[model samples]
Target chain A: MRLIITTMAIIVAIWLIPFVLSDESGLKFGWPYSVFFTLATLFGGFLFYLLRMPPMGPFTSSRRAIGSVVLVFLVSIGIITLLANVSPQFAFEGAATAGATAEERGKAVFNDPKVGCFLCHTVQGAGGTRGPDLTHIATVAANRKPGMSAQDYLKESLENPGAYVVPSFDNIMPPVAKALSPEAFSDLMTYLKALK
Target chain B: MPPDVPLINDRLVLWVVSELHLLFAAFVLGSPIFIVISEILGVRTRDARFERLARETMRIVAISYSLTALFGAAMTFVLVARYQTLSNFIFQRFYPIFGLYATFIVVETILMYAYLYSWDALERRKSLHISIGVALNVVGTLVMFLMNGVGSFMLTPPSSPDRARLWELVNNATWTGLNLHRFIANIAFGGFMVALFAAFMYLTSRKEEDSAFYDWMGYIGNFIGVAALIALPVAGYIYTKEIFAYNATISTLLMADKLAWFFVIQGTMVGLLFLGAGYYMWLSIQRIKGGPRFRTYFRGVFWVALIGLIIWLVPQNFLPSLTTKPAGPIGEVAIPEKAIFLGLMPAKGLAVSAIILVTAFLYLLYRQAIATGTMTWGRIDTKAQLTLTFLPAMAVYTMTFMGAVRESARGEWHIFQFMADKSAESYLTPLGYAATVSGLITVIFFLLVSGIFWLGFKVGH
Candidate 1:
């Protein structure tokens, strides 16, 4: 009983903390934020649960240990796949989303060498071929058939690299999808979403 | 094309290759199973024949050990030379696991050598040598696990689109399950191959002594085969399920082919073998006379098995594949999902149910064999033993036939077909892997059976 309650309290606490910390946005933060925080926290807790047990013992714990080990091992792989999906510079979003107009924000980040993708990808038949040409990336990948919403594709490209690969190219892209500052990911997503 | 070994005796070449791998897989696959059987037989009879059979089987396995190693090398050569594209894909996509595969084979080879040569000396130190051999063969099975993972990995590379890296690709998701399936499958395959080899030899013997000797060998071989064969379908079911999960499309395509028909045919063979096996168990009761009490038991077991076989033979909707949820970005479109219910082959379900029924009734019917131990050829029955020796030889031939058929089929050489599209013999990979796996399995099965039977014998006394 105590074990179950303590676990629930930890869950409730994870949901409550993000709101308190983010009063600055004062955006109506609610359950969606709670879901992400809760899921992330639970994922972390599961890893902890696995770590405490020696493998090949109690069946449940052992199975979890092995499964967790595989999943933990998958983390880097997941990132590599993310890298395969998108431009590498999506790894960062500027600290300022405070007062800039949306289009100004796109221009600020668009060619900013620090996080701009032009360093690796060519656009408009110019820039670099070190990465895939992205001038039509929004058309080819984001708006690929079967309805990958432009927003989802843009976000995935930044986060998961292996999600889509142009034919003839092996998945060599680096994952910057998760690296996008959440604010930046959302902002960039909003920008890329409009491309289609 | 490098012309066929210029009018070389095709049969001779086939015989050589077939015999060599069968000889090797005999020792490699057979020894552990033989050891178990010899131990049980020895315990039951308190006779030197049982013990002598074990020792002799081990001794021959010892000789076959070198042969098996040599043939294994030939198989590797066969793969690289004959099936390079599929071979390259195997090496590249499955590099990490295949590396472990090489390690296991080296370990198995070394341990088997030690197992064979040291046996005479180890006879005085029986338990330890047997245990050591056990440990070595356990490692042998582990090698099978690594190899199975590599093979199964090709069939089902972990569908984790979310994961990357060579290790992740090799281990993938289905690796463990496939490994489990292969481990068990080999044991069954190994055991049955050995038994059939012995049985064939038993049937062909002319001399009374040879017939009697081969009969004992056959009994041991069949028991091993039946044990392995029975366990195999269960593991195979699980493997099919994993195949289903990894890619329904591939699974669906696979089920549509004649190869899927072969699976059914194999299941029928298994049913017959099961019934035949139960009948044989009945026959073993009257070792003093050629047994006659098993007739009714035979009929009962056969009828039950026939029902299972018939049920198994019933055709189903294979082409109009089951509907499945479309997996990626695609909406409302069906992605190939190997229908989970496909695992419940009505025939298989009936077969297992039949086995249970057979076991119950046959156990009641064959009380004579159960009550009195007559499951062995007498010490004087040298004919049976020698006759049993050659069945493995024929089995190798039969497998070579099936292998040819598998290779010649349509779309069987998907990987090689991709590369060798222009070549005349592009349809070689399926044939090659089948041949390699089958031929290796046969020889190893025999060598192991013979060696273990030899070990169980008390030669000097």
Candidate 2:
């Protein structure tokens, strides 16, 4: 019962302090309200628990400890979820808005959840480490294997990732030849080519 | 296209959560390295002390593993929910790798439990148990290396075309160097934490035998920490060189520009670490039945360390940047030309190296002093135990500040040159704010870690 009350008090303080004490007030008072309120709520809870509970403390009861754990976890998750969902400005939809040119469209495909190119390959240096970095794929694709041209190497590798595993990398990439249509594949290739 | 959400600084949110996650991750990754070492030492020497210590260490590791998972899951949620586009890009690129990483986690979890629970049942099959220890270490090290590769890619990404090849990105310019640095650092951190636990046990232990046992454990823990500490600077140097090679601008930003003060702060903490270790070792020499013959030798070491620290902490720049207005009067002092070398890279690097070498030499002397049988085990006093506590605290603080420096070095970009952090909430956080947040997070991290350690004490007892 005390744990529930203490947690509620802290939560209320978190919300109330921010609403009541504006930024100007915080600056004028020469105190960080967030830090002060947080510390106060914590100290208050500690004092409440110590004065009300027995000498040994609340944690002596396994039930109380477990309750506090569950309460804290739920409260933390609740706040984090609220913050994330409520604040859309924190999210980026740049790629979604910028897919126009062939290269840009290819980037979209590379970043697309459906195409899953990024699942194995990095475009322009920021992707998966499971496969090799393809930042300079256009430069090295032709020379990676003998008797294989750049296009041939890319095609063969996409169709059969295990055929020519890079020396240091594990051959864990599943064949994606069936996954990408020729047009989408071409678009990805365009993105890859523009990477240089 | 920023999402139409209301105000709340997501960058600050990410920074705090990620820092917390990293602290736990360090302990989780670091503890196993020493656990395996302690186990192997026991098996070879047939020393029951080593075996007991290893078991105790495993208990703590088991408790911390859950916290690590909890924080890791939280960090992932922040990435996916708060920065959806950025998370989507990374996830799309490495979903399969993520799958593999998850599989490793499951295997690692089972191995960790088996290693902890089957201690007595598999007592007779010692070889099999040892093999499990080795497997646990292997998987743990592999996980660190894999993550290091990903982290290195963010700082020094491959050029566009090379980024196409997943293997190339996996083996990015900074990957090997970072792996090596982190590997050494993990061992050192693990050893420090073990020493901290042993010190705590020694302080609270009522029985003479228990105190003696923990005193010995604390000594060995510090020993491993010093051993790893000796190699840390060299690995760090190599990592920095690789960063320089990959991108001069980013390296410059870290070492000489806006982030330079963080390095100075890191150097001060590192200098304190050396001094703390030296003081602890000097105090520990009292355990010798005969008086410490190396008192004069360690005095000289203290001098070297102090001098090195003074040189290392010398501010590289006293003035604010040309673009920014000075914060205070001290920021108006123009740096003298000839005295600039004192704050330069070579001077700072050499000073740090000297400090490390001096610390290492003191440790070697301690080992020799102990080997002569003149030193009896377990006479470490409360003061020495207090020093052990300070060492890990300083290390945690240093790591948090350095983490800030590293993340902030990229300026406004999330992926260095490749992608910009274009969200409405994205901005380069001022150093004052960053440092304040980092300090707060460090305190919270240490408190939580201490809580975990205390909880483990309840379980172990």
Candidate 3:
């Protein structure tokens, strides 16, 4: 009877987590999930404790040991299914909205998840160190090769990244030109060139 | 594809062969240090059981040494024939040390054989025999250190490769950390392998005396494993910190990007190891006269460990793949904004530390029980013996999974930023694919290990 009452209280607590934690805007925090997960884990642990108590613990008999294994396996599967179905999806905010100007549109393209330029190349101070920082790419591009124009160098870089290996960096950049539409590519170039 | 290896996938073959070589190599290198310690203890205490353990463990190591060489040779051949460019690059840089490595191997081989053969002959000259054993371990360790110099250089090469001195290449950013990590891990791996052998012998032994001896042996083996395991996470942390300090991108790749899920699985496996070890200790108490008195304290320990396991298993983000979009409702909803904090390093680090602490606490409790009460070694329940058997399986999987994570951290490069893998099979395998390959490798390894165990038994008879 005590187990039943305690379990009911726990369920009530879990059910009330969102309501208790959320604001007027319904902007839920991590508190609800944390509390719910902790409550569920504690409740499961309690059940385990009860099952392992004297008189019929898993270690007491061969039958009980095998039964415990099965029970644990089934519980694991159930938990996995529940987590898969109920856990919140990782929210990746959509790409920046298309801007009025070519440079703005190009900035949007660079920030696009599909383009993934921001994943490696730093614009100002934001990005991965795996590749060379491109904060001064507009100025550096013309000087990278003796005769190539800035636009040609940047275009060549997007199309064939391995052509000019940056010093101290591996030639690891993917072909962004293949992934981009022609217009998007032009806008991205414009945005990059305007960086200076 | 290399024309010389048309029938097989060269990379997969090299991966399996090299992993097999490492498995045997770990045992060969690790078993000796403990075996020598066991020998020293036997000499000091005049305990014949310790002497027999040292002799028996040496016999197994002797057998595995040949297997290690065989696999190593096969791996070398595959590398030279199929991955010619990589072979050339590594050889060009580290040719001088290769001779030193080979010389160490030869000396270690001679010492191992002499130590094994001179046991009865040096019964009167026991000090001489022990000296040889110590020398054997030193040479074996030197070989591993040399190999580590080559291996760690691949992942974290000298910053200025063209201008690097020989010492700079040998002592790369991650070299010392990798050496420390592997040194401790080898000890733990070696201990677990001993436990595995003891458990097998205990199960198969018909004589009561043999069962008692094997049971005690299993206990000592597990003791070594647990003691070394306690220090492993700290060593691993140092190694990871070095990787981060050297290259934040590679660290991010491991902790937050493509390889993040691999760590989640690794956490589960490591958590199981701790829990399994604790359970074995709990069951171990049943064999002591005053053991049941301590049973009540287990509940709290168990609960703390469970919480740690849960925390360690939590993912920072639930996204299965960073590159691919999910096909279900999971793709639609965002992780609770604040709950994300619970899955990060602070929580996971605390969780692992807690798990290790609880394991240490349980070991202490077991020790207390043993100190206070009389022990009946072979009288433990079958469940306890089964738990002992389960630990080695978890240890093997953890080792393999970790190896995959470390190797894959290089991603498309053969040597971090220095050499791009322009081969047909350069792309990183997805987590699912890698897991399948790892599982297959693990199964094959266990099968080979079973044969090695069988050979030990055969030699004993």
> What TM-score does each of the candidates earn?
0.52, 0.68, 0.77
lDDT per model, in order? 0.49, 0.68, 0.76
Considering chain A alone, what is the TM-score of candidate 3?
0.52
Rank order (by DockQ, best first): 3, 2, 1
Error of 2 at A177 (Å): 40
How far in Å is the alpha carbon of A17 misplaced in model 3? 5.3
Report residue B194 deviation for candidate 2 (angstroms).
0.8
How far off is residue A61 in model 3, in Å? Answer: 18
Supply the global lDDT for candidate 2. 0.68
Model 3 C-alpha lDDT per residue in residues B1-461, reported as the tens digit of each score: 22433444776788888888888898899889999999999989999999989988898899888999999999999999998988998887898889898899899999999999999999999999999999999999999999999989989999876568878999999998999999999998888878877877776666779878888888888898899999999999999999999887688767766677777667766776787777777777877998888877776787788788877776655554443334443312225555566677888889889989988988999999999999997766655556666677767767776887888788667787778777766655555555556655666766677677777684467
Cα miss at B43, model 3 (Å)? 1.8
Residues forming the 10-long window of minimal summed lDDT in candidate 3 chain B: B325-334
Question: Comparing candidate 2 with candidate 3, which one achieves the higher TM-score?
Answer: 3
Error of 2 at A175 (Å): 43
Give the per-residue lDDT of model 2 (tens digit) for B344-427. Answer: 778887988898888888888887887774755556655566667767766666677778777766655677766778876554
Q: How many clashes would you count in candidate 3? A: 1
Q: Write the per-residue lDDT of candidate 1 for residues B1-461, one digit (tens) a residue.
A: 12432433332344356446644564456456666467446757786656655655565555556666677677667667755765676677667777777787777777766766676687677667667677777787776666655544544554442244676655654677666654554454455444544443344334556556655665666556555556656665676677567554344434532234334434433454465456455434434343455655555565566555545543332211122112332211211123223235564586666775675566455555545544445332322222223223333333443333323332323331122233333322222233334444444444454444444332332
